[model samples]
Each structure stands twice: as structure tokens, then as C-alpha cells.
Target: MQLIRSILAAPLLRSRIASIAQLRRTFSSSTSVSARAFKYVVSRRVKQKPAKKTNFWVKQHLKTGRRIKYPPYPYGDSNIFKRSNRGLFGGKFPMQGHSVSSELEKKNLRRWLPNANKTTLYSSVLKKRIRLHVVASVMKTIKKEGGLDNYLTKDKPARIKELGPRGWRLRYAVLLRLKEQEAKRLRGR
Candidate 1:
């Protein structure tokens, strides 16, 4: 029984050595692989690659027009404006400041929230009226751009970057609608 156990243990030890030898040959002999990668392999530590930056939602929305979850704000991310989606503030978010009291000379933290009014915006491209909570700045910009449709469909980087998830979805919807109309018009002709 002792002899049999020794025989089994000898092969197991040899197999372990064989595996190590294979690993050394696989890594050390490959000039294409780096020494750091070989060290990671020997240590059994996996080197994770960095995540690629992508506009995944924009691509997917344009391709499939599928429902997308609200992603993080692209610019000036602040947790204070929790209800940013509830209103279009044009780039203005809630501001935090110290409010001084005259009587005690105490500096208190205060947040100045933008006033959002319920308003209706007409979209000529979509032929629809959208009721939304909008701030004065956003309303002014929309009017300046000629209408809500123009504002949403603008290809400027600043405009695209500042648009939150809700705005992005709305923009894509309007774009798809416009494309469909154009295709139909072309087909008729």
C-alpha cells in the first residue's frame, strides 16, 4: 500500500513540475509577450484592460430606436440637482453658496434652485406638442433656435454634451421622425 501511494505521489509531483515548465516555455519563449505579462501569469494574477470610452446609447438609439435607461450627466455632474430631468435648465444647475445672516453673522449653506415652469413646446418636425417643466434659459434658447425641434436636432458638440438622457432620447425620437418623413417624401416622388 505504501509503495502504491509513493508511485501515485511521484506522478502528481511530476505533473506539477510539467505544468510549471509548460508555463515558462509558453511565456518566456514568446518575444511578442511582455515580461510583465509573464510575471502576471506566473503569479496567477489577471491584468484587466481599461474600459473603452464610447457613446453607446447614441449609437444604439440611432440604430434600433430601443428604450434606454437614464445614463449619468455628461458635463458638470452634481448630485444636488437630483431632479435635473424634471426640468430643462439649459446648462444651469442648482448652485450652492453661503448665505450670511445679518443678526448673528452666521454663514449658512444654501442652495439656489432654478425655477421651472410648466410650459408647452411645439415641434414642427414631429408635428406634436410636448408639455414639459422648463427654465427661462432653456425656453429662451429654444425660441432662439427657432423652435424646440431645431434646439433638439442641433449637431453642435456643446449642445449634444449638455443634453441629459431625457434630452438625448427626445432628440433621437425627433430625428427618427424626420428621417421617416423624408424617406416617405422621396418615395412619393
Candidate 2:
């Protein structure tokens, strides 16, 4: 309250108030100069911070620093994994198999099941072909489901293993692509 009064009681504000009161007295000499404006100044002493927030403001502030507003790959909103992430932009590239071991695994099983190649799910014997299979399976699933917007990242497994080995493989491939897309979008912006 003391700080509030000091800011409002500045000489500039006091002179402005006095000038307004002088004008009011000139216009209506019958009215007291001590009235209306003095009460208004005391009541509105604190110039509260602006409450209007926009998407642009958030994006602008977040983008000002090296910080990336998007969540790190395979995790939640806050960067609790800051200790673990040493990479450029902090955990953007992802550790080996982290995406699969983390979130998005269950999403693959639930959304990609209809079109996924069950045989190539974990075929380490043919690594290249298996990678292709996962990407193809994801594309097929995306097309079958209409588009990528349907796969909500938040719907991933609370316990990752239930996504299964095949689901894990597929999830990693999609996670890579999504990371690439995000990088490109940020660069473009």
C-alpha cells in the first residue's frame, strides 16, 4: 500500500490532478474543488497490470529467449528433464529410443493398428525395411483416420510397456517425423 501511494503521489500525477480540478472549478464554480477527482485518484492509486493476454504475446515472450515453447520430445509441458537434456534447444533431438520408451507408444497401437504391418513391427533382421514399414504403417493409419490431427499426444500411455514392442517401434518413427516438422516450423517462423 505504501509503494502504491508513492507511485500515484508523484509530483507529475499531483499536478495533473490539480489541473483537472482547476478546470472543473472554472466550469462549475458552485462545486467544491476538493470533491470527485480526489476520491477517484485515491481509489485508483494502483495502475494494475494489464490483464489482456494473447497467443501472440505468449509466443513472442517465449521465442525471445533460446527457449522452445513446445514440450520436449516424449514428455510433459515443463522441462523437469532439464538435467537430462544437454542437446541444442534442450532435448529437441531426443536420446536413442527415448520417444518409444516414453510417450506416444500407446497412440501408435490404438491409432496405427488397423494399417500397421504386424510382421515388420520388430524385425531387427531387416532394420531398413522395418523402418520403412513403421513409416508406411503410420502414413497408412493417418490416411485411414483422415489426418495427423486426430492423434492427440496427451492420450499416450501412463505405463509405456502396454504399447507393446511393435507399437514402440512405430511410435519412434512418428516421433522423429514430428520433431522434424516442429523444427522446420520454428525455423520458418
Candidate 3:
């Protein structure tokens, strides 16, 4: 009777051990899965650097190496009273704190002023006031050449040589400008 009971107990003990082993395997797998998910969440929550804001004026100044000063007045200031002097001449004349001739010389204004109309001059002034160096340079070149037609017809090779390898780019831009101006004029009429 004792031997039979011992044999039965041994098989029962083996079965119990197998069940415990299965439980341990299941628990370990579940814990490992949870640990991996926790690690993923922690990685995702890590702080990132904020994006920097670029100022147009500063960028233009840097690119062109020009000293583009801000206007004396604030952005929202009323130009009604000040318009009499500044508006008539388009502020191209000398003022209390600003010298138009000096500004023009600094920006190489002679290249464009001969061909510029009131509209063109006004637009150029706006660009300069805003400190857009790239547009200002393009405007000056385009105006100096007296439109795309003149540039293309006058001397293709000579102009190209004078402008170096990138002359084609300037020609393309001038052509686009001409088309845009023509479209605008047609619309206005």
C-alpha cells in the first residue's frame, strides 16, 4: 500500500512541476512584451529641439553683404502727415536721417534708374525698404538692360560674355518679368 501511494505521488509531483514551468514561461513572455512596449514609449517621449525662425531682412543682408538699415518710423506709423515730403519725391531725395544718394550709390542705383518709371521706381523703393537684396539686384539688372527684347536683340553673345556663364539665367528671368508686365498692362487696360 505504501509503495503504491509513493508511485502515485511521484507522477502527481511531476505534473505539478510541468504546470509551474508553463506558468513561468507565460509570465516571462508577457513581462518581456510589456517591457519592450514601455521602452518604445520612453523613446517616443524624448524631447526634440525647436525649429528656428528666419528673418527675411537678415537673410538678404547676409547673402548680399549690404547694409540695409530699417526705416526711421515704426511699421504701423501713419504716413499721412509725412507723405507730403516723402510721397511727392518717392523719398528719393535727402531726408533728415537718410541720404537717398548715398543709399542709391550703396545699392548701385545708376544701373536701373535711367529706365525706371514711376511704377518701377515705386516697386524698387518698396523692395529696398523691405531689405530684399536679391530682388533689388535683379530689378536693377533688368531695368539697366532696358527689358528682355533689348537685351536679346542688341547683343546676345556680348551680353552673355559680360554676364559670364549665368547670363542665360538672367535672360530667362527678364523674359518672365516682361511677360508678367505685359499681362498686368493688358489687364489694367
Candidate 4:
């Protein structure tokens, strides 16, 4: 009772007690802000790390050290492999650009299509004939690799890129056939 009497006697303590009671009432009913209440404030001038710049295409060009005339289609957008099933142009796509002949002449847009020919390629491993439309460059590569089997089985990045979907499927089939043949030979022995 004396402590309560002493608290009531002090003007500042009395006002503080009254404010706390009012604050409790306000909190029970609705949200309220008091002058004495502590608040968490976020600083606007807080330091942040800058985002790193990435020049992917520039890096690729620098690594190759050659300007690419034709770039492969984005495989992420759709199944590029399915589209390449028609004819394997070694991942080459038709390029369309404006061709300017003279300084005063208007730009003429033209589509340059690769020369694809239907050719028969023999795979010594699978012992079968494959007839498909292929570009001259692909044919030259197959010849250089010795045969279709070697061309398909080679794990080179350039060769894999040129293979496309049809070649990839053919490689799997050839591998399975080779495995079966090996098993048969072992059984005979």
C-alpha cells in the first residue's frame, strides 16, 4: 500500500503508469503506437554486393577465336533433336540475313539453305546400310572417321554435336548389337 501511494505521489511515474494502462487497453482492442515503444527500423542506406556480369556468348567467341557464321538452335525451347530427325546437317541451321550488293542498293534478304543429299552409308559394326539426307561436311567426316560405325561411336564433342537424334539412336542400337554378338562369341568358346 505504501509503494502504491509513493508511485501515485510521483507525477512522472503516475503519467507513465497511466500511459501503460492505456497502451494495454489499445493493444487488446486495436494496434497502437506509443512514444516510448521501441520499433525495429530498416536502414535505407544499407550496403549490398553488386551483381556479377556474365558475358556467355562473348566468352564462347573468345574461346573459339572465330566468328560463328551459324549458331545451333536453342535446345531448351523445344526438342531440336526431333526437328533434326528430317536431315542431319551437322547441327547447321538455315541462316536468313539481308545481303547488300552496292552502297546505294537496298538490302535484299535471302535464306541460305545447306545442300543436303540422300546418301547410303555402310556401318561395318552393325553390318547394315543407312540411307539418309546428309550435308557434304558430314559425309566428309564419316569418310575421315573410316566408317559410319566409327563416326557414330566416336566420343568427340564435334562428332556428337553433328550426330543429332537419328545418329544417337543408331549408336545405341549398334552398341546393343555389338554386345549381343560378343556374348554369342563367348558362349561358342
Q: Estimate each model's TM-score.
A: 0.56, 0.22, 0.22, 0.53
Question: Model 3, range 62-136, lDDT digits (tens) per residue?
Answer: 235764443332222324333222121211222233224654554322322212133323222112222111233
**Model 4 RMSD vs true structure:** 20.6
lDDT (CA) per prediction: 0.71, 0.40, 0.40, 0.67
Clashing pairs for predicted structure model 1, backbone only: none
**Candidate 1's C-alpha lDDT?**
0.71
| lDDT at residue 75 of model 1 (Cα atoms) | 62
Worst 10 residues of 4 by lDDT: 54-63
Residue 14 in candidate 4, Cα distance off native in Å = 99
Better of 2 and 4 by lDDT: 4
Q: Which one is best on TM-score?
A: 1
User: CA lDDT of 11 in candidate 1?
Assistant: 74
Give the Å error, residue 173, model 2.
Answer: 1.3
The local lDDT score (0 to 100) that residue 133 gets in candidate 2 is: 26
How do the residues 11-129 of candidate 1 rate in per-residue lDDT, one tens digit apiece?
A: 77879878888888754555653335544445456889898653333343534666544444456443656566555666668788999999999999999888778898877876767
TM-score for model 4? 0.53
Per-residue alpha-carbon lDDT of candidate 4 for residues 1-189, written as tens digits (9 for 90 to 100): 998898799999889989999888743434555654566775578788798653221222323576422234223222533455655568776778988878778899998777688998777775667777888888888789788787778877766666775666666666656776898899999
Task: Identify the candidate with maximal lDDT.
Answer: 1
